[model samples]
Target chain A: MRDVYVIGAGTTRFGELWERSFRDIGIEAGIKAINDSGITGNDIDALYIGNMSAGAFINQEHVGALIADYVGLAGSLHIPATRVEAAGASGALAFKEAYLSISSGMYDIVVVGGAEKMTDIGDEMANYITSMAIDQEWETVFGATYASLQAMMARAHMERYGTTREQLGMVSVINHRHGALNPDAQFQREIKLETVLKSGYVAEPLRVFDMAPLSDGAAALVLASGDVARKYTDRPVKVKAIGQASDTISLHDRREICTMDSTVYAAKRAYDMAGMGPEDIDVAEVYDSSTIAEIMAIEDLGFFPKGEGGKAVEDEKIALGGEIPINTSGGLKARGHPVGATGVAQIVEIVKQLRGDADRRQVKDAKIGLAHAVGGSGATAVVSILEAEI
Target chain B: MNMPRFWREKQGRYNLVGNRCTNCGTYYFPKRDICPKCHRKSIGKMEEVRFKGTGKVVSWTIVHDAHPDYKDMRPYIMAIIELEEGPRLTGQIVDCSLDEIHTGMRVRDTFRKLSEDGKDGVIFYGYKFRPVKE
Candidate 1:
């Protein structure tokens, strides 16, 4: 297989996008990525869209066809457009498919995008739809919300690893601080750790601040073969490796609730394929659906040893200028998690940092970056490694 | 959300029934056709097994934010119970307060009403856990 590279990336400002339809925001992000890559619609070979639930959110399905037609890539162009759904990891899975297509020599110029319009359905229905990602027959039927599931994991982590509430609060504090520097971030204001601590409990041990808001947005990336990547941009972020894995859907089915085995497996595969260890990664973005999740992800991804992730955050090791900066785009916590859009958004942030385009939140001398996306309670995880073309 | 889907799992939901892989002695809750450990080899070797309702709370959460269906049950205690039969399952910890639930606390299953679709709709019943009072 040949090498793949990200030529361009773009994302919409994440928040309650009241006016834009799902297809509209998706087209906007795609067009921006095309423009950023200096490529026209005619240059695209195929399109892949990552979407969790446009059907439930907007009562629309066949989103790939809708987006393709809206972006003027359908009919005459008749591009092979497909939609990938793995709940929250939809975006990363789309990227992985696009990468494989390009690497297989079947397609050279591919556009991978993720979009979700969650606010349209109202919070209650939207949340109910989101809960479909869990075990529908068992977990969801018993009233297990995502926050409550993660809260249980947090409780287990606290009980076994001695992870403190203060440590859990630190994840939100750091991410919000970075979000304050990001122009497109939803909550672009710094919040205190005390704010997270004193926030009303969404689930015991997990506060409202611990959760990522229901957001509506889109993100897109233009990928090309390594040979053709530099033709689009002088500096292309090379896709060193891509890895994905899945586990039992229910949290109870997992051998250990505190550890996301999917993340560990996926990250291990990505690192092996990249021939690089965790220490080689200069920057990273791990899924932070909740503050506790960020802690678990860092450890599961091998960034910090098991049970040490919390203390590492407490020591500012995950801060922007600290030992290995994480979630510089403010993460899902403050950057806004539009479910499907999040995986691609994480990639967009990494590409910006690699290109030296992220002004204030840029990590110094960033050479390699990793983006991790999780689908439903750690059942699915996708890890991608990107290196600056030196 | 369909009646048949719930009805189909009534055996397990009501009696804590599961399947044990006779070949490997591994147990599974919500019985599966094939054992995850032995895969296709253990397909015909699976046997029905019932767990003793008794267990310990492995982890739990007092859910304040809940689904639309469970809005009335806000701040309800949900927990992961490690059953005596070596299988784990999720259920609400009833007959207890938030302050009373913790990891390692002993508990046992009790049949209770899960939720109703509407005021006049089907009232789904399933097993829930309560503190194993000494």
Candidate 2:
């Protein structure tokens, strides 16, 4: 397999983009990525989009064709556009496909993007639709919401490791501080631990502040073969390795509730492929749809020992400018989790840090970065390792 | 949300019916054609088993925000119960307040109305758990 490198990345401000339509945000991000890559739309060879529930959210399907046509790559260009979905990890799966396309010599230049228009539907309906990612018959049929599932994990983590509510609150406080520095983040104000503790409960043990808000946004990346990467940009971030894995869709089926086995498996494979350990990573972007999810991710990714992730956060080890800076883009917590766009957005943040472009939240002299994305209750996980070319 | 789809699961929903894998001696809630652990080895050898519905709560949450279908059911308690047969299932823990529910509390399955599609539409009924009375 040939090596793949990301030449450009772009993302729209994440929030309740009520005025923008699904295709509109998708096109905007795509165009920005193309422009950033110093290439024209005509230079793109293929397109892959990651969208979780466009059909249910907006009453539209065939989004691959819709995005391709809306982006002016139809007819003569005939770009083979594909749509990939794995719940929240849709964006990372799309990026993985684009990387494979370039690495397998199937395509030299590929545009990978992820978008979600969540606010188009009301929150109640959106909640119901999002639950479709899990076992609809068994899980959702019994009235299980996503927050409830994550809450269950939080409860288990607390009981097993004696994780405190304050430790979980610390994750939110730190992420909001980083989000305050991010101009494109949805929630740009720093929050305190007291704010999280006082927030009304959405699910017990998980307050409104502990959960990621429903967001609508898009993120895109331009990937090229390593040999041709220099033509687009002088600074290219190499995709050193990528790993994807799946677990039982239902949380009840998992062998252990506190630990997400898929994340552990994917990270192990990714680390092996990259010939680097978790300690070697200079910066990391993890899926923190909920605060407890972040703690579990840190442990599952090997960044912290099991059951000690909460303590690590309290010690300020994972904060920006700390030992191992994480979620410098505010993570899904404060950065906004646009479901489909989150994974790609994570990559965009990493690329910015690797290029030394993240002014306030940059990890000093960052060379290697890791991005982790998970779907459902750890049903699917994707881990990618990237290194700065210079 | 087809009627047949809901009707097909009536057995598992109404009764605590599941399947046990003879090869691995593991039980699965909602039954299974093949055991996840034993795979093909347990295929065709799976036995329909009925759970006693007695179990302990493994974890739980008080959900204040939920799907529109359960709008009236907000602030409900959902729990993962480890059944006496060793299979775990998610069910609403009724007849108990958020303050009363705790992990390791003994509970028993009870049938309850889940939700209705509309006034004249089908009213779905499923199994829920309630704390075992001393």
Best-performing candidate as measured by TM-score: 1
Fnat of every candidate, listed in order:
0.78, 0.84
- Candidate 2 lDDT over residue span A56-118, tens digit each: 999999999899999999866888899999999999999999999999998999999999999
Candidate 2: what is its chain A TM-score? Answer: 0.99
- At residue A216, give the lDDT of candidate 2: 92
What does the lDDT read for residue B47 in candidate 1? 97
Which residue pairs show backbone clashes in model 1? none
Residues A40-139 of candidate 1: C-alpha lDDT, one tens digit per residue: 9889999999999998999999999999999999988999999999999999999999999999999999999999999987787887888889998889
Q: Candidate 1: lDDT of A67?
A: 90
Worst 10 residues of 1 chain A by lDDT: A121-130
Question: What is model 2's interface RMSD?
Answer: 0.8
